[model samples]
Target: MALLGYARVSTSHQKLTAQISELKSSGVREDRIFTDMMSGATDEREGLQRLLARAEQEDIILCTKMDRLGRNTSDMIKIVDTCYKKGIAIRFLENGLSTEGTMGKMVIQILAAVAEAERERILERTNEGRVVAMAAGVKFGRKPHQGSGMALELIHLDTPIKLVMEKTGISRATYFRLKNHQRRS
Candidate 1:
């Protein structure tokens, strides 16, 4: 009969502070909380695994939102199902939903499906926009290293690679990446 809190963020750049604050304010002890920084697309969550293993029958699993568990319907359903079979209940604080009864059960299925569909729509639109941008000669991702050209040019001039890197402020990793790209081309 414990309340275990779970918090997640899609990227390392995102913070867990907000979700952790919410969980703590909800009376979930700090020691009973688990947090992970990873995308929903990733399946390996060390924090979640430990939380699930520690949860016992009649224990409650608390989270900020349904999507934090996972993005897709099947994945969410699978997680809920696992909890249910173990006699554990899941509560989403933001939605005020609990999987301790019949009605809550139905709502979870609907929410999971809706979340999955929304994720799909977002990905589709992003791909479409990328295609349109590419057609317009737009570049995506990090701009090429400013010194890449200089490094390459210096390499061609028979300068030592280290000297070229120091002069152009190019990192060894970036220099190797550019050299690999050149080889591939």
Candidate 2:
């Protein structure tokens, strides 16, 4: 019946000190606290993996917020459901919520739905912004390489394809395509 703590930040630039301190204040030992400095969009975090792997029946997993557990509501619900099935409980310190009984589980479900709705709203707004930008002729994705002109010049000068690629950091396929396009022009 160990009490475990999991803390996470989306980027390396973010600090874990606050979450660690909160967990410690809640009686979780430093060794019992696991952390990851990565996005919540992926479940590939080493610290999170270790915590889940080490979880046993009746264990309590604690986090500062629900988002620390996961950003995706479905994924979060699946994780909670799995833990519940394993007799493991989850507590979110900031929200003062826990999954220890029927009511707690219900609260978690409501929160998950709210989170999912918020995510959907954000996605919709982002897509609308993208559409507006595209309608305004805004270009997205990688810009043309500045070295392309140099590569073309080298190709026109009869430089070896390998040498051109090396000098301009262009791939073999790109070099050949540009070379052929140059010939056509």
Question: All models: lDDT?
Answer: 0.88, 0.91
Tens-digit lDDT track of model 2 for 1-185: 99999999999999999999999999999999999999887677899989988899999999999989888877787888888988999999998999999789879978978987898899999999999999999999977676789999999999998899889999888898888899999
**TM per prediction:** 0.79, 0.69
lDDT of candidate 2 vs native? Answer: 0.91
Worst 10 residues of 2 by lDDT: 70-79
* Per-residue lDDT over 1-185 for candidate 1, one digit per residue giving the tens place of the 0 to 100 score: 99899999989999999999999999899999998898765446898889889999999999999888887787788788889889999999997999888778778989889888888899999999999999999998999889999988886677887898899999989888877776687
Off by over 4 Å in 2: 133-185
Most TM-score-accurate candidate: 1
Assess the local accuracy of residue 121 in candidate 2 as a C-alpha lDDT between 0 and 100: 98
RMSD of 2: 4.1
